[model samples]
Structures are given as C-alpha cells and as structure tokens.
Target: MIEEPGRVVAIEREAVWIEALDEAACPGCTASVGCGRWSFDWLETPRRRRRIRALSVMPLRVGDAVVVGIREDFLLRSTLAIYLLPLLGLFVCTIAIQQLGFGESLMIPAGFLGFVSVWAMVRRISRRQMNDPTLQPVVLRALPGASEGQVRQAAF
Candidate 1:
C-alpha cells in the first residue's frame, strides 16, 4: 500500500472528498528544458490536487487529515489497461486486417485506421474506468490521532 497524505476538503454522509498534496522533485541536469516533455510536466506540476471520494470509514470533519492508500495491483492493472491494451489492440487489428483479402494499398490504410479506432476505444474505456469508485484506489486507513490543525499542515 502506497500511502499519500491528503486533506479532507469535504465530508458528506457517505463519502469523503480529498485533495492530495503535491510532491516536487528537481530533474537534475538532464537538459530536458525546451523539450515537449519538460513543458508538459511544467504545465501539470502546479495542478496537483486529486479530488477523490472515499468510503466513509469514520465521522471525518472537513479539515481532517487522512491517508489514502493506492494498492500496487490497482496501479499495475490501470497502467496495463491504459498503455499496453492500446498497443495490443493495434497489433491485433493490424494482423486481422492483413488476413482479409484486400489489396496492399487498402490493407495498409485500413489497418492504420483500425489501429487508431481501437486506440480511441481503449482511451474511452480507460476514462470510464478511472471514474469508477471501485476502480479508484482504496483508503486502507486514516490517522484519527492527528489534530485538525496538524492534518491541515501535514506533508504528503
């Protein structure tokens, strides 16, 4: 279980909403600057609040400090579904298109298009999966010992 410290932004009868704290790391002298990768990371680094609804385990107040656990298996499964499935779909679709009795020109374009279609479908499925409460990482435990003030200032 990978635990992340978060603040309880809102508390309802059935669920608790939490915004995760951001952890920063300096990318050492890798000359990643000016690259698209660097720019993307820079854009996303500041927006790190992850709004999550968790099962109401205890009577959590709005400023409570809680620990959210992301199970390893859940992360692995999510990564595979999002990244590998799309590549696998592309490969399977390409092979299937090749076996169909079409001219090379049509086969190539059709296979490419089919791969794109499957990739799009996989992306859609991933989005839906992420929104599922069951699929969202579980809250294994919460530290009720911490004071409300401490919870607010706790580091992730």
Candidate 2:
C-alpha cells in the first residue's frame, strides 16, 4: 500500500473528504553543497492542493488526521496505461502501414489515428471503472492524538 498523510476536511455518511498534506521538497542530489540547482529557485511554483474523497470504515470528523492509501498494483497499472499504451499503438500502426507499402507519407496520419483511437479506448475503460474500489484511494487509518471532541469543538 502507498500511504500519505491527510486531514479530513469534510464528512459524508460513509466517506471523508481529505486534503492531502504536501510533502517536503526532496533533498539535493550528490553534488548538493555546490549544486547550481538552487539558482533556478524562481522556476519553482506552488502547486494546487489535492483533495480526494475516500471510503472510511471508522467514524471520522472534519479536522481529523488520517492516513490515505491505494494499492501499488493499481498505481502501476494506471501509470503504464497512461504512458506506454499510446506509444505502443503509434509504433504498431506505423509498422503496419509500412508493411502494407502505403509509403512513408501515410505513416504520420496512421500513427496519429492509432494514438487517438487507443486514447479513446483507454478513456472509455477508465470511465467505466470510475467507481472501482481497486482504483480508488481508501482511508487506511486515523492518526493518533486527534480527539473527536477537539475536532467537534473546532468545527464550530
């Protein structure tokens, strides 16, 4: 399971909406002390916070700290589907066009068509899986020390 710390921002009957905590920036590489990367500090920009709703089995309240997680297999499968499938489609289409002796002129168009088709297929599959539990993030556990009384008092 891949887990991240988040805070419950809202509560539904069976789910909690969480705001993920932004992790600290990574430490510098091997040449840290003398690295020139810091010179490009201006290039860095603040990113929008990610908010997600996760199924929870335990009682939760807004302001509660929690751990959210998703399966590793789910993460890997999504990464491959988004990045690799399109390239594979492009190459296969180009190769097929070449084999048919349609000339190089049609290669670009054929590859584009294949890429778009595969993207549409992937999109359809993902839409169908919008409610799939395996692909959805879940509330793994609540962090200790945040009392429900305290959260309730704070909510007002």
Candidate 3:
C-alpha cells in the first residue's frame, strides 16, 4: 500500500473530501540527493491544491489530518490498461489492415478508430473498478493534536 498525508476538507456521511499535502522532495528517484531537480522540486508543484473523495472508515471531521492509502498494484494495473492497451491496439489495427491490401488513408483511420475503441473500453472498465476496495483510497489514520485551524503538514 502507498500512503500519503492529507487533511479532511469536508465530510458527508461515510465519504470524506481529502486534500493531499504536496511533497517537495523527489519521489523515489535514484539520485534524490544529488539531482538538482530534487533539490528544487518545489518549482514544479502547482499553485492550487488537489483533492479526492475517499472512504472514511473511521470517525472523521472537517479539518482533521489523516493518512490515506491506496494499493500499488491497483494503480499499476489501471495505468497499463489506460495507456499501453490502446497504443497496442493502434499499431495492430494499422499493420493488419495494410497487409489486407487497404489504402494508407483507410489504414490510418482504422488505426485511430481502434485506439479510440480501446480507450472507451478502458473508461468503462475503470468505472466498474472504482467500486473495488483494493483500488479505493481509505483513510488509514487520523493525526492526533492537529486541529481544524492548523495548516496541513507536507508528507514526503
């Protein structure tokens, strides 16, 4: 499981809106200390904060600091399906159509259509996958002593 520190922005029953604290350090890079980019990572962060709706397994409230976690395998699987599959589909469709004596124009369009079709399928698949517990982010723990008025601490 991969975990990150977040602050609860809102609560509606069992669902909680969490804003993950942005980290300024390089994320698991080989040259974390030596790389110049790692030392200046703050320049890449967006000015706006990003939030997500995650499950509130335990009692939570607005302004509570929490640790949220998601399974690593779930993320890896989704990335492969969304990106690699459609690209493979594009190449396969183009090559097969060309070998079957289709014109270059037709082959190109067919390849694009194949890529689109695969992408559509991936979206639908992800919608269903959303309900899976393994993929869903869960509130792991609530940080004690952190009040609603306190500024969120960045977790590396």
Question: Who wins the lDDT comparison?
Answer: 3
The number of clashing residue pairs in model 3 is 0
C-alpha TM-scores of all predictions: 0.65, 0.78, 0.79
What tens digits encode model 3's per-residue C-alpha lDDT throughout 33-137? Answer: 788766666566643467988887788878788878788888788789989999998999999999999999899999998899999999998898777765778
- Pitting candidate 1 against candidate 2, the one with the higher lDDT is 2
lDDT of 1 by residue, 120-149 (tens): 887787777766676665555576768644
Q: What C-alpha lDDT do the candidate models reach, one value each? A: 0.68, 0.76, 0.78
Off by over 4 Å in 3: 24-46, 147-156
lDDT of 1 at 113: 77
Predicted candidate 2 versus true structure: per-residue lDDT over 41-141, tens digit per residue: 44555333579989888998788888788889988998899889988999999999999999888999999998988888888998999887668889988
Model 3 lDDT-worst window of ten: 147-156
